[model samples]
Target: MSAHQPTQHVASYYAASANPGPERPSVSGRVECDVCVVGAGFTGISAALHLAEQGQSVVVLEAARVGFGASGRNGGQLVNSYSRDMDVIEAKYGEETARALGSMAFEGNRIIRDRIAQYGIACDLKEGNVFAACNAKQLEGLREHQALWQRYGHDQLELLEGEAVKREVGSSRYTGALIDHSGGHIHPLNLVLGQAAAFESLGGVIYEQSPVTQLTHGEPVVLTTPGGEVRAQRVVLAGNAYMQGVEPRLESKSMPCGTQIITTEPLDEATARALLPNDMAVEDCNYLLDYYRLTADNRLLYGGGTSYGGQDLASIEAVIRPKLLKTFPQLADIKVDYAWSGNFLLTLNRLPQFGRLNDNVYFAQGYSGHGVTCSHLAGKLIAETMRGESERFDAFAGLPHLPFPGGRLLRVPFSALGAWYYSTRDKLGI
Candidate 1:
C-alpha cells in the first residue's frame, strides 16, 4: 500500500463476503448541509440518517470506503448496553441519568433491525446473543446483573448455569451464562451500507474517501479535506478512534486500542450447530473476553486479545488460535481462513465520552468496547441535540470521563500496563 494510498477495508470475513454496494463518489468541490458528519462508520452515518429523516440536509465524510473501520470489522455482537453496564453508570452518576440512558440501551439494536426490514438489506441479521461467564465469580456477577436490569423494567434475560450453559454453547468452558434473546448479530458492514443507502433515499449525501484535515470555527463550521470542503451550521466528529489530530482537545479524551478476530473454514451443519446449537453470538466475562459466533455459512468467527496504540501483532492467527483451541480443542486440525484487527476508542472510566467541543460542534467516542449499539444510540442523541432537544444528550454528557493518565503519546503503554494487571487476575481466576 502506498503512503498516500486511500484506505480500504481490511481483508477479513466481512470484506470477503461484503454485499454489493454502489461505489459512492469521493468528495470534490464545495458541499453545504445542516449537519456535516465526519467518519462514515456507524456513528456518523447513524447521525446522518436520523438527521436526514427529520428533513435536515446532511453530509457524511468518510476517509475510506463505508464501514471500513471498527464499525465494519467488529466482533458483530449486538450487545444491548454501553461498555459499562447500567448499574455502574447509576453508581457513578445517578438514577435519573441512568434511567434516561437505560431506556434507550436497546434502541440501537432495534434501529438496525428496523432499517434492515425497511430497506431489505441482506446482512444475514440473526437474533440472540449470550454473555458467558468464565468462573464462579463472573457467574454470580451475571446473576446480580440480571436482577438489576429487571429492576429497570428489562426482564428479557435468562440465566444458564453450568450444564445449562452447555445446552446453549457446546463448550463446557463457561460456568454460567446470561442469554439475551433480544440481542443479536449482523453483517455489520452491510448494516452500515444499508443505513447509508437509506440516508440517500431520505435526500442525504455520503462522500467516501473524504477525510477532514482541518476544522475552521465560524458561523458555519468549515471542514477542509484534500479533495473537498464541507460547510455546515452544525458538525459532528463521529470518527472515534480514527479521528486523530482533527481536534486537539477531542484527541485527549480517548486511546485507540486494537482488537483482533479470526474465522475458520466453513464447517459442516452438524458441527456448526453442535458448537452453537441456538445460533447465539457468545462473549465471555474475562477481562480480555473471547467472543465467537457461527456465521451464516457455518464458519466459526472467534476474536479476542487487545493491542494498545493500535499496534497489530505480526499474525493475528498466531495470537488468537491458541485461545480458540483452549476453548474448543476439538478443532485442532481446523484451518484458519481469515484474521484481522481493528481499533476502538477507550476512555479511562470505561464509559463513552459524549459532549460538544463548542456550540454547533458535537462528538461521541470511547465506547470502550460496546460500540455496535451505543454508537447508534449516540447518533440519535446527537440529532436530538441539533434539534434543540438536549436532555438525552446531556444525560450522557454529564457522565464524567477522565483523560488517560499520560497524554496520548504515553497513554497507550499506561493502559497496557493496567490491562496486564487485569489479565493476570483473569488468569488466576481471582
Candidate 2:
C-alpha cells in the first residue's frame, strides 16, 4: 500500500450533504463467500445488493471507501443512454441491435429509480434533463437524436426550439435542446452510501481499506488484499479506473480521465428558481460538455471540463468557475464552496466493456461519462449472469473493445492528444 492513502471521498457538495453512516469493516484474515466483489462503488454495491437479496453470500472490498471513486464525484446527471450515440450503435450493430441497446439504456434510468424507491434512498431525485445545443449544427444533431429515440419507442423526449430552450434553461448559449423527462439528477454520493447501507442491511459484507493486489482464478477465485484474502466461487471486478495494476489485460482496454466540478454557496430558493425553474439538469452538446444542476438546498453544482493527464484541484476550480459564471453570471457575487476532481474510465469505442476473463471472473466497466444509471443496470445484469441467466450480460459482453493504441505507459498521452483534437473540432464547429 502507498504511504499516504487516497482521500476516501472527494470534497464535493454531494459528500458534504451525504447521510451520516457507519464505516464498513476492514477485511481481516481469510474469508470466503459465494461472490467476492472488488471496488465498492455503485456497480459493486448495486451488484452485492441484488446478489445478497437472492440469498447469496457476497463480500465487497474497497481500496478506499464506498463511492470514493467516480461514483461520488460525477456530474450526477442520470441521462438515459449509453456513452455511444445512437447513430454509432446503428452503424456498428445495425438497426435492430442498436434499438435493443437503446431500450436497455432507457431501462437503466428506471433501474436506478426503482432501487432508490425500494431501498428508500434519499438522494434528492429530480425529474427532467435538457441536452442543450449551442450551435445550429448541434441543434440539427439534437433533432436527429430526438427522432432516433422516438423511433426506438422512447417518445418521452421533446424537442425544444431556440427560444423555448432559453426559457427552459435560462441560458441563451443554447440554440435548442432535447428534453428527456426520464433523465434527472441525484445527490450521487448519498445514493452510493445509501446503497452500501442497504446492501449491508441485507447481510452483504463490505470491507474498506482493502485493495485486491492479486487474483488467482479457478473453481473459486482467490483475491488477496494487504491484510486479508477472499476465496469465492465468482469474482466481479467493478473497480473501473481504480483497478490499478490488478488486471493488466483489462487495464489496457480503458484509461483514466480526470474531470472537475465546483459548487456555489447556497442560494435562496427564489434565486435558485430563477436559475432553473423546473430544477432540471442541463448539459450542453459540446464534445467536451458542461453539466450543471441545482441542489436541494439551492446550491449550484456545476461540473464541466476535464484534465487529461493529471489534476490540480485549485487549477480546476480556477478554470471551471469562469465557465459556471458564463452560464449564470448573476451569481458573480456568491461564494464558491466546493471543488474536486476524480478519475473515470473510458473505452476507445466510448462504450462499456463487460466480459468474463475466464468462466468465473466477470468484469464490467468503461461506462465513459455515463456511469450513474448504466452502473445500476450493469449490476443487475451481473447478478443475473451469476444466477445462470446470461442474455443481457451477453449483449454488452459482445461489444468489441480494442486495447489503447499506445500501450499502458503511453496511453494517457495518446488519449490526451486525441481529446484535444476532438475539443478543437468542437470549438471549430467541424
Candidate 3:
C-alpha cells in the first residue's frame, strides 16, 4: 500500500463546538531551543508544557492545528490504564516490571485530572466508566479483570452484575461490567487546546502548520521545516500515527488504523438519563469495541467501527450509525448531527512504544486505543528523562516491540489479514 497523505480534521461535533481559543502562528524563521517537539498532540504538547515548566526553552511544531490529530478527535474516554492488560504485561515481562508499569498507568489518569483543575479547563469532566461485557466469555474476562485489580490493590473498580450493569448503563445487551470511578470523559479538543495554552503560558512556543521535513541527529539535533529550522539540544518525535515522513524507522513499527464516530441531536433529560442512568462512559468488550458516552448537552456521542483502508464523511457515518442504534435503538428516529474519523497508531503488541531512537532523540507512540491517559503520562516521563531521571521511562522502554513483519510494503496486507480473522471470530461468537 502507498503512504497516505496527511488529512484535515473532519467537521465533527467537537470541531463545531470547540471553545474559542487564540490562534498560534506558524514557524517562519530559524529558531533554537532546549528541545524541539514534532506534532502538537497530547504527547508533544504535554511534553512541551512539562519541559517549559522546568525552565527549559521548548518549541512545539505541528503540521496541523493543535488537537487536529487523534488527541483532539478520539472517543474522549480517559481510561486509567495502558492499552494492553496487566496480565498481558506480566506474561511478556516479569510480575515486578508489570506492577510498576501498572502503577504508572494509574498515575496517568491522575495527571490529566490534576491538569484540568490546575489549568481550569472547561471541558466537561465526569467520574465514572464501564467496560461492558457482550458475551458469557467476555463476562468471565471481566470477572478475572476485577480480581486482578483487587490483587493489585486497585479498589476503584467494582464488578457490576447483570442488573447492576443495566442500572449503570441502559443496555440489556451487556451481561455485566467493571465500573471504574477513576475513568472518565472530557472534551478532547478542549483538553488539547488547554494544554497548548498552558504550554505557551509557561514560555514555550508552538508553531502550527509547521511539519518537520528533515532531521539531523547529533549533540544538538537539527529539524528542518518548510519555512524554518530548529536546532535543539534534544528532539522529541510525538507525531504518532501522523508522523508522515519524519522518521522512517519508527514509521515501520505501526500502521494507521482509522476509527469512526457519530453524535446524535441533543436528547431531552429524561431520554438521556434513560439511555445512560449514571452518565458513565460505556465500552463493550470486543476486539472492535463500541464506546459511547453522553455529552454535557445531553447528546449521545457514540463511536465504533474501524476502517483499515481510509475514511470519508459518508463512509464513517455509514459504519457508525448502525452500531449506535444497536445499543440504543430508540435513537433510530433521531438524526445524526455529526460524523467523523481519526487515525490512531496500532502496534502488534497493543502497547504504547516509548523509548529513545538514540540517547538524544526520544520517541513515543502506539497507545493503541488507550492514548489520552497514556500519552499524558508518557509526556511527563519524557520530561523526567530529559532531567536525567530515567527509572519510569526505562520501565516502558524495556518493553519489547517488534517491527512490522513485512516492512513498509507488505505490512498493511499482513495487518488486514490478522484483523479480518479477529473480526470473523467476533462475529462467530468464538
Candidate 4:
C-alpha cells in the first residue's frame, strides 16, 4: 500500500459480509462544525451520532471507511466493564471513583441495544455471553468475578458447572463458566454502519478518506487534511490505535497492539448450534485469551493472541487454529473462510485514558482490549462533557495516565515479558 493510498476496509469476514454503505467524499475546502471528530471508528461515530441527535453541527473525518479499524474487526462480543474490572479500579483508585465508573460500566451495552431498536438497525443482535474457566482456580475466579459484578449493580449473571456448562458450550474444556444474560454479540460492522447512517439522517456529515494530518489546537481548533481544513469549537480525537501520528500526546501513554481473528466456512446448522448451543459468545479465562461465537450465518468466529507494537503476524491462521481445535477437535476438517488482524490501543495499567490535550481538545483512547462497549461509553461521556455534564466524564479524566515503563520504543518487549509472566501463572493455576 502506498503512503498516501486511499484507505479501504481490511479483507476480513466483516468486510466481505458487510452491509452496503456509500463511499463518502473526503474533506474539501474550508469546513466548519460545532464538533470535529478525528477518526471514524466506534468512538468517533458514537460521539458524532450523539452530538447530531442533540442538534449540533458534527463533522466526522475518517482516514479509512467507518468501522474499518478494530471496531469492525473485533470478536463482536459485547463484554461489559473496562479492561481492568471494577475491583482493580477500586483497589488502585478509590471506592468512590470505582462506584462512579461502575455505574456506567454496563451503560454501553444498553446504548447499543437502544440504538439498534430506535434506529431499526439489522446487525444480527444476539444475547448472552459466557466467561469460560479452564481450570479449578479460574473457576473460582469466575465465582469471585460474579460476586464483584453483582456488587456493582449488574446482576444478570448465572454460574454454570458440570453438565450445565456443556449444555451451553459443547466443549469439555471448561471446568465451569459464568454466563452474562445481558452480554451478547452482533455483526459489529453492520452495527457501526447503521449508526453512521443514523448519524447522517440526523444531519451529521462524515468525511471518509480524510485523515487529519495537522491539528492546530485553540479555542476554535483547526484540523487540516490533505484536501481541506475543518474549524470547530471543540475536537475529539477518537482514533484509538490508528491515531499514531496524528497526536503525539496520546502516543506516549498508550501502545498499539494487534489481535487476530478467523471465521470458518458456514457450518451445518446442527454443528453450529452444537458449538454454541444457546448462541452466546464465549471467552476463556487466560492471560492470552481465546474468544469465539457462532456468526448469524452459522460460521464459527474464533479470535485470540496479541502482537505487541502493531506488528503484523506472518500467519493469523497458524496462531489461532490450534486453539480452536483444542476446544473442539472434531472441527479439524472445517475450513477457515477468512483471517485478519486489527490493532487496539493498550495502556500500561490496562485502563482507558480519557483526558484533554488543552482546554477544548479532548480525547478518549486506550481501551486496552475491552473496547467494544467502553468506546461507546467514552463517546457518550464526551458528549456529556460538552453539554456541561462533566461529572461522569471527570470520573475517567481524573484518572492518572502513565506512559509505558520503557517508553514507546521498548514498550512492546516490556509488555510481552509481563504477558509471558502472567500467562505462565495462568498455566500453573497460581
Candidate 5:
C-alpha cells in the first residue's frame, strides 16, 4: 500500500470549486524546523497554523495538495464533538475525561471561525446545522442529544417539531430536528487551502507532493521524503485515513471507511430554498446517516453510504443517488454534476485516537466520521501538548483504543457486519 494519496486533489466538487492556491514545491535538500508535520490536511494544517501562532518554526509535508484527503472531501458540516458524544465519553471513560472533552467540544467551530475572520478566508461560511430525526424514536434521541449537549454548556440547541422543523429544513422525511445554532458548514477544500495560506503567511512552510517515506525517531526526528528530509524536535501524524503505510502503529487500531457524496446541478434560488428553507446543513439520525446541505451555488450536496475498509464503490452516484431520492423524491429528475468518495478513519469505539508514538512523536487520528471539527480540536490540543501543556491533550490521549476484533485481514467483514446490524436497527427504527 502507498503511504499517501496521489500528488493531487481528487476529482470532486470541492476540488473543482477549491480556492486558488500556490503549488508548493516538494521537499528539497535538508530543512530543520521546531516541528515537522506529516500530512497537510486539516490536522496538519491546523497544527502548523497553531504552532506558527505559538512562535514555532513549522514545516508541513503533504502527500498531495493541502486538504487533498478527507479534510478537503468530507461532508463539510462543522458538527461539534467527537464521533462519540460527551455522554458516551462520560459513560465509557469517566466524568473527568468527559469534562475535559466538553470544555473543548465547541472550540473547534470557534477556531475555524477565528481562522476565517483572522485570515479573511472566503469559504462560503454558513451558520446552523440540523440533526433531523426520521422517526419518533429518533426525535426522542434528538431531545436527548439536545439535553446532553446543554449539560456540557453548549446552549445553542433548539428542538424543532412539526411545522417548526420544516421552517428550518424543507424535508418532510424528518419527524423533528435539533438545531445547533453554533454548528454549520463550509467549503471544506477552500477552508483548508485558506488555512494553508495563513500558515505560509506566518512563516510556516508546506511542501506539497511530499510523502514521508521514512521516519527515524530521536530528539530531532528525521522525516525523509522523496526529494529531501525534514528534521524537527517533534512530528505530528495527522493524515487520518490517508496516512496508511506512513505509520503502521496508528493503522493497527483504526480502519479506513469510504463514504460517497454527490452534488446536483445548480438549482434556482427558489428551488434550493424550498429544499432547505434556512439553508442549514442537515444529517439524519441514523447509525448510517444521510447528510445534505445546499451549496453556495444552490446545488443540493447529499452524501451517505459507507464502504468499510476504504473500498471504493463501483458507482458512487448509484449508491448515493438513491439515498438522495429517498429523502427528496422531487429531485428525481435533477442531474448530478459531481460524485466522489473519501475515506474517514474509524476506531472500534467510534472515538478519535490521540496519543504519542513516543515522547516527541505524537499522533491524532481515527476521528471516525467527525473529522471536520474534531481535527481542528486535535490541532489545538496537539499544539498545547507540544508547548508543554498536556492537561487538555491528555484527556483524549488517555483513552484506550482497541484494534478491530478480526485484525486487518478480517476487519472489513467484521465492520461490515456491525454496520449491517446498526443499519438494520435504523431501518426498524428501534
Candidate 6:
C-alpha cells in the first residue's frame, strides 16, 4: 500500500489512457428525480442510461469519476456470461432457474455493443474471447461446458484441443480451449465513460465527487451527500464493493475482495500479434485464473491471483509481475508499464444479489468478479424493476444468497480459508 492512499482511480493503465472528458461538479444542493442511482460505474451508468432513455428523471450520483472503480480498472475482457457458469446453476438451482440466468447472461454484451454503435463511442471494442484450459481436468471441463452452454442456445462456442489451442494462443501452456465468437473485449474505462456520455445525451444528470454520507428511506428516498441531498421516488445502491459505510445492510450481504493487474510497455504490432495472433482476450479455468488480452495500443495486459479476504500489497508490481512472467516467461525482461488493484464484492453464494433493501430502494451487486457483463445486466434489470416490471429482476433475485457465516468482521478469515482449499485444488489440477 502506498504511504498516502489513492482516493481517485488507482494508478492504472486505464487511468493513464482514459478519455478526455470534463470533470463533473459535485452535488451541492437539493435535487429531486424519478430515480437516484448511486455509483457511476457500469451498473449505475447503464441503469441511468436505460432509465433516462425511457424518459425517467434520472440522476446519477458518483463518488468518483465515471468508470473510476472496477468499470475502469478491470481486465477489459467481455466474457459474455456470469461468473457462475450455467452448469453450476443447473446443479444447484435446477434448469428453470438456470434458463432464467442464462437468458440474460449474454444480453449485457448486446447492450454494450448497441450503446457503442448507437453513440459511436470509441472504446476500442474487439471481438472474440478465448477460454484456455490449463490441465487435463480443465480441458474436460471445457468439453462439458461447450455442450452445456450449447444446450442453452449458445451456438457461438467453438472448442479447440491440443494443437488448436496452441495455434490460437501462441502458447503451449493450455492443453485445449473454448473460443466464444459472440464474446468480445473493449477498453472498459472508455466503455463506461461512453455510457456516461450516452446517459448525458439522454438528459440524465450526474454528480461526481459526491460521496453519499447517509440514506434515509421514506416516501421519496433521501440520499445525504457531502455537498447535497437527493430525494427520489426510487433509489439504487450500485456502489458495489466500494460502498463502504454507505449502507450496512448492503455491505453485510457481500464481502469486498480484490484482484490486481499489470500492463506491459506497448509492444511493436508484430510482437503483439505474435503473442496473441488472433487478438482474442484469454482467461484460464483455474480457481484463481489468469486473464490476459492484447490492448488496442499493442500492450499485453496480464492479471491474475485473487485475494479472497482482500489484500492491499505494498507493491502490486511485486505481487503481479511474477504472475505475468509465469504465463509468458519469454517476457520476463519486458518493462512493466502499469500496476494497479481494485475490489469487487464477493457473495458467499457467488451469484449476484439483486433485490430491494425495501420498497423503492433496489440494489444489484456481487457479480463475484464478473462485473463486466452482469453489472450492465443489473442496470437493465434495475431499470425494468423501477418501471414496475420486475419479472427479469425477480429471476436474478430468485438466486439464493446468504450472509457471510460470521458476518463482516470474520468473513475475510473464513473466505481466506476457503480460498486456500480451492486454490490448492487449482494447483493440484483437480
TM-scores for every candidate against the unseen true structure = 0.97, 0.97, 0.96, 0.98, 0.98, 0.97
Best by lDDT: 4
Model 1 lowest lDDT segment of ten? 1-10
Q: State candidate 2's TM-score.
A: 0.97
lDDT of 2 by residue, 279-382 (tens): 99999888788999998898898988866544555677788988888888887888989988888888899999999999899999999899998899999999
- lDDT of all the models against the reference? 0.89, 0.87, 0.86, 0.92, 0.90, 0.87
Q: Residue-wise lDDT of candidate 1 within 14-122, one digit each (tens)?
A: 9999888888888798988888999999999999999998899999998888998899999998998888888888898888888998888888888778778988888
Could you tell me the lDDT of residue 131 within candidate 4? Answer: 97
Error of 2 at 222 (Å): 1.0
How many residue pairs clash (N, CA or C atoms closer than 3 angstroms) in each of the candidate models, in the order given?
Answer: 0, 0, 0, 0, 0, 2
Report the Cα lDDT for residue 47, model 6.
91
Question: What RMSD does each model have against the real structure?
Answer: 1.5, 1.4, 2.0, 1.2, 1.2, 1.9
lDDT of 5 at 118: 94
Off by more than 4 A, model 1: 1-6
Q: Assess candidate 1 and give its lDDT.
A: 0.89
| Better-scoring candidate (TM-score), 1 or 5 | 5
Better of 1 and 5 by lDDT: 5
Indicate the worst ten consecutive residues by lDDT in candidate 4: 1-10
* TM-score, model 6 to reference: 0.97
* Candidate 6: regions farther than 4 A off: 1-5
